[model samples]
Target chain A: MIDEKELVIALKSQNECERAFQILVNLYKERLYWHIRKIVLNHEDTDDILQNTFIKIYKNIHKFEEKSKLYTWMYRIATNESITFLNKKAKKKNITIEEVKNQLIENLESDIYFEGNQIQILFQKAINTLPQKQQLVFNMKYFEDHTYENLSEILETSVGGLKSSYHIAVKKITAYIKLNETI
Target chain B: MKRRENIDKFKVPTNYFDEFENHLLNKINEEVLPKNIGFKTPTGYFNKLDFNIKRKNNSRLKEGKLIPVVSKKTFMYAASIAAMVLLVFSVLKDATRVYTLEEIEISSIENFINEGNIQLKQHEISILFTDEILNNITSNQSRLSGNQLENYLLENINDLNALLPY
Candidate 1:
């Protein structure tokens, strides 16, 4: 595997950028797709956001200053794109962003792409109750297994703040699941 | 942490991610994206970096110029055209409809009027008396039908009294 330095250098190079980009896509596509899918809850939407994320990365490669790791920068872009996609959907439907999230949860039962069983559905509903930022923190920390330090860098939050948000999110999810669980 | 919490609840189709990159590449541009790449980075990678940068730019992925058939604007245009077509068809259907006195049994007309389905606006009833129609009524001085007294009196009382001159 090419190290970060070589990847950056190659991505910046006009001649070798495409090959470097392909490598980048191969490495990160699934990770980013899942990241987006958890928020959007729609396979087609995740696919769309994933495509846009890569395209945005390709377009802006020359402008990347490398102050942050490329993956971190890409994650931030993907998160923003997912939020933007949600906001646009809300506007189109004349619903609040919260309502859009609720609608997505409702759609999950009927969505052919959703394979989650009842517990997972309840898990999603619990996650949906958190503030969007906390939801991001929890998903990254819990599912992606991102360390506080890594998530701090990727999310541009202090490690302490990320921890607090994740802790709160976990507690809320637990309470919600227990409150609604069937015997 | 519970053991169950560690297990993944969400699932995707088999090989969904493994098949993703190549399919994505094909969707973007089948011909442009490089398929075969075996990475073996030897020592002195930094030394060859400048040589690699100076090589041909032909490997660069050209932005895929999407050929559009039915985009948002196209769909919107189609919807508006469909709406307009429906509007025109309804209007034309209404305009071309006619009811001749000979085709109707009087009782059906009476039933329609009694049911309030045949109700006409006052202004619409006024339009039934063109100047030619009034002159024909006065010239022939014939059958008066369908609230004809109010219609003729409203329009032609002076003409009637002048013709009687009594």
Candidate 2:
């Protein structure tokens, strides 16, 4: 693993950028890809957003102020790019974001990327019913096990705010599953 | 309790990350290498772009060249107006020129008086015919003879007291 500060210094330096960036991509691609896949729910879409996220990070690395860890900044970019991609897909289909989510849920069975059992499918449906922010809060905490403090830095929100959103998200998901689960 | 069985539902093919870099590098090279960009440009836009930009810049440089030529023509018009004003002023001055008295001639007075209207009173005529000319006439014996004088005296004997106060 590359030292965070050293990677940042090389990323900011013009001479060593190509090699440093390649390293950066190699290191974070899996973690970032899973994080995006959780939101977008398909491999191809995740791959698409992941590519955009790294390109965005490479382009804006000079403006990285070293205020946060490099991965956290990359997470922030990945989060934004995924949201933007979903919104674009929603617009292209002339549907609201909620309608788009429902459509994605309907198409999950046929999607080669998704191989979840019935419970997992219900889990995805319950998660999709959430507001966009609550969905993010739940996914990062539940799957990635991201701490509230770290989530705060990546999301630029207060830790207390993140906890409140996370708890609310959990309650909603549990309630949605209890209400809708067939067996 | 059921939610606690947090088996991560998503999966990737084995060694996906191990192979991801090369694919990503290929994608990145296709995107970032400039020559193999993933985006498509309009047809022939590059072929025409250089010619178009240079034509516009050359037009702009040509536009910059136009200003001084117009100023030169304006300067020429001003100079011609000044010359015309000076020529008219010199011609008018010569037309009004004043000559010295030495340069002028006084013609014959008799010819001038004869040509012009002149009148004289009897007293003015007496001044012109002076007493000396009268005396010269009276003293000449050839002009009045003694016998003619005696005869003129006898003829004017009754008017002698009025004619000669003595």
Candidate 3:
């Protein structure tokens, strides 16, 4: 594991910034990729957003305040970038954001990159039914195993709020799955 | 049998089982849901990711540097050219503009006449013309032949008195 402090120091320094950036990318790319993929649900878009997230990180590393963990900070950037991307997409397509998400879920059926079976696909559709914040909280908490505190830091929500969000998300998802399971 | 009945019954909290069904159902649902979302990337995507990002970063840096250097001069040059084009366009626009009689609003003409800017008396107007021009105006053998004069009179019967050199 790279020492985050040293890596940050090197990133802020002109002489070592490039080398440290490579380490940063190598260390966080897959994690960020997965985090972004869960949000956007398409590999190509995830890839584009991942690249943009890294570019943003590289550009803004100097402004990193270190109040949060480096990973969480990066996670925040990835999350915001993904949401912005989706909003732009929705705006471009003249659809609501929810409709865009539903469209994405529908496209997943034909997506070559989606290896999920019918159940998994249905699971994703259920997740798609969630409010955006709940979806984020659920994915990060359930799939990524992020602690409420970490989610709070990444999502800028109170820990208590994140906990409640996750709890409600789990219940809703469970109910959705059960309701749809018969079909 | 009395001794067996006297044995402490397995004490259960009231309503414990009430929520158990829901709890168990939740657990089952959790277990049944797929752990993986089944999203996959292209082969070797991770291996190439860092490299591609670095390449992009380098290109971005190069572009950042190149823009200021090129744009400072280019912008000034462009601005100058655009200003010149605009100046030339405005000058040409004003120079070549033809105003139709309808375009000269009656109100503006009324304003000009009311302002005494063009209140030349008939005698002053006649003085402004040379004798040669005055002869041309009154001459029967001038540019407007008899036929043209008759045609003008026929076409503008109401304005015939205005057409006379009064």
Candidate 4:
């Protein structure tokens, strides 16, 4: 396993930066890709956002204060990039971001990369109904299995807030599923 | 008997125990949503990603130092001022000179249209000409016969529809 501290040091060094970046890509590309994919719901858009996130990370490595874990900082960047992308799409189409996400969920049926069955699609539809923060909280906590502390760092929310958001999100999702179960 | 009754008298918070079963059930039901969201990437996408990112980074590095420091707005303001100065100089050089429609090139008119500076509504355009002149222009401009117009519309109906306001 590549030590994150050593990687960060090498990334900061002039000669070793490029090699370290390559290692960074190899290490976190899949994790970041999935994290973004859950938010965006489209493979191609997720891929583009992931690339932009990496580019931003590469350019701003010197500004990384190391106050947070490197992964969490990178996750924050990826999350912001994904949200920015969705906001841009919403602006271009003159729709709300929720509408954009709903459209994405609708398109999931036809996406070749989406292997979800009917119930899975319904679950995504339920998640789409949630407020953006709760959706993120639930996805990270329930799907990615992130701890409250790690989530607090990445989301910039307090641990108490994250826990409350996750709790509400879970309750809402459970109600949605139960209500729609007959369908 | 008195001690057993007092021990049994301990009470719980209102609705706490009542809601506990429902909350627990909801927690269990939360698992009904599948963990696998069924997203998959194309084969070899990750393998190719690093190379793509490297190429992009290298290209950016090569082009970074060559970027002009001046913003586009600054260049546009400079161009506008230069054009105004030239116009003033030409008018001073010839006080009574008048230019005909032919003096303005068609490409210049096209460029002006493409620049999006002409935002006149239909009624505003109509207001520019008197009724007689408008009638004359409409009567004189029969370049496309009805058949040709219909054919053109048939070929580009979608494009024409897209250009409509509503």
Candidate 5:
């Protein structure tokens, strides 16, 4: 793997900047996609939001101050893009964010890609029941296994607040799963 | 070792979620995005940098290959025609300004209006008539305010005074 610092240098040089950018894309694309996917739900929506996030990253690469790691910056963009996509959809469909999430889960359950994984589908559904902030915190911790410090940097929330949010999210999801376990 | 063996049952098997997660992961890994996928901008899946560099530089090469001679002549001809049209317009405008009869008449009318003193008799007549009408109205208003004729009429008559104009 190319050192990120070396890659940044190469990107700044204008020559072979495209090559460096390609490397950055390959390195972070799927990771960013999954992070975005967990937020948005629905594979197709994730794919669209993922592509848009990367395109935005590509266009705004010059603006990146490199004060934070590129991955963190990209993750922030992906999360925000996913949230924005959901908010727009919710507004257009005249539904609350929670309703939008429930609709997404319903689509996911019938989806060929999601129908087979009962556990993840249940887990995702339970997560969807959470408040948007709690859902984000839970995803970053449970699925991505990101540290609180890292999450705080990406989410721009205090680590303690994120931890409590994650705890509440887990408790709610766990109770939901337990309630549904018999079915 | 015993606990580890016992834990295998509780441990999620990689294949357990494979049917869904694997398919999802594979679909996600696919270069092509699924339909209804919003914002399908393929980021970093392929060599975009190389593609962009080639595209950006290709325009220069393409531009260079275009035969400049015929296009230049065509461009010059179009430009010359435009210039001639503009020149004709300006010359015609100047000629009209200097020699046009209508302009001469308009200029003379303007000069006469500016330099000569003229009395507006009709405006004075209208003003005087308006003043006379206003004075008559005010006098009638004063008489109506001072007299109780309207009240007396209202008390005596019913619908006739209401229907009739003073």
Candidate 6:
């Protein structure tokens, strides 16, 4: 992997900028794609959002202030795009956010991506039970193990507040899994 | 801002069974690997764009030779239109009403005094005129009282002398 700072320097150079952006796209495409997929729960939707994220990053790279890492900025864009996609989908389908999430969970149970995976399938259901904010925080922290500082930068939130959010998310998911197993 | 030094205590590890971890790791590995941009884009694609750029550049170089002939006729047409516009404006300039300084000042004052009914409140006008009259009357009354008080004191001076002779 190219050093991030070096990649940024290349992005600022007159001729190497496009090449640097291509490198960035190759670097983050998969992780970002799955992150968005987990939110939207569809491979095709993930593909669309992933492409759009890269395109937006390319167009707005000049506006990036470098106060945060490039990864954090890209993650923020992916999160917003995924959330926006889900919101628009919910509106168009005339469904509540809760109903949409429950439907996604049901679909995830039978999803090709969830094939032959009992624990991951259950865990995804548990995550679906969480509120939207908690679900996002839980997915990043629990699965991706992204640091609270990086999450804070992407979310524009305080690390202390995020820690609480993660804590609540974990508590809720644990309760959900236990309750589901009992039933 | 509280220092989040030991927030890992909040992380209750879900039973990430070995199979689950394997599945997750496989997904991560698949996702993090660099995509082959040229894998599907095929070779010689960029070369096509370069060829197009060169062709356009050559065309532009040829167009540079034809500018002088085109510019002379464009400039003549532009100048003729500009002259016609200036002549029309000059002919109409006298018909446009031109107010003198005194006329402009008087009209502006009248306009200011009668700006609009929206701003001209009856109570506000009455209060303003009342304030001016009251101020004038108050000053005059004070002067008249001062003169009367002086006359009364002077007329009573002989009576005081008769009552208390030295």
Off by over 4 Å in 6: A116-121, B1-166
lDDT of 4 at B97: 77
**What is the per-residue lDDT of model 4 for residues B1-166, given as tens digits with 9 covering 90 to 100?**
9999998999886777876776586578776767788888999999999998888777878987777788899999999999999999987896677879899999998888779978768898789899999888888777769967745654555222223221
Off by over 4 Å in 3: B1-28, B67-166
**Residue pairs with backbone atoms closer than 3 Å in model 2 (clashes):** none
User: How do the residues A28-143 of candidate 4 rate in per-residue lDDT, one tens digit apiece?
Assistant: 99989999999999998998888878887898888887888899888988887787777667867878899999999999999999899988888998898899988999899888
Candidates 2 and 5, the one with greater TM-score: 5
Kindly indicate the candidate among 4 and 6 with the higher lDDT.
4
**Candidate ordering by DockQ (highest first):** 4, 3, 5, 6, 1, 2
Ten contiguous residues with the weakest lDDT in model 5 chain B: B30-39
Worst 10 residues of 3 chain B by lDDT: B157-166
Which of the two, 4 or 6, has more TM-score? 4
Alpha-carbon RMSD, candidate 3:
23.3
Instruction: Using lDDT, give the best candidate's number.
Output: 4
For residues B1-166, write the lDDT of model 6, one tens digit per residue.
2457567456644654634654454445334322211111224533343333345445645876764655887899999999999999989898768877776777676687787634767787667776779789789877778757644544454222123211
- Residue by residue across B76-124, what tens digits does model 5's lDDT show? 9999999999999888785544566655677776677668655557677
True-vs-predicted CA distance for residue B8, candidate 6, Å:
24
Every model: Cα RMSD to truth: 27.2, 47.4, 23.3, 13.4, 23.0, 25.2
| TM-scores for every predicted model | 0.53, 0.52, 0.65, 0.65, 0.57, 0.53
In terms of lDDT, the poorest run of 10 residues in model 1 chain B is: B32-41
Clashing residue pairs, backbone N/CA/C < 3 A, model 3:
none
lDDT of 3 by residue, A1-183 (tens): 678899989999999988888888888888889999999999999998899789888887877878888888788778877877776677678787889988898898899999888888889888988999999998888888888778887788998688667667778887888899897
lDDT minimum window of 10 residues, candidate 4 chain A: A83-92
CA error at residue A13 for candidate 4, angstroms? 0.7
The ten-residue window of minimal lDDT in model 2 chain B covers B32-41
- Candidate 6 chain B lDDT trough over 10 residues, lowest sum: B33-42
Off by over 4 Å in 1: B1-166
State which docking tier applies to candidate 3. incorrect
lDDT (CA) for every model shown? 0.71, 0.70, 0.82, 0.84, 0.67, 0.67
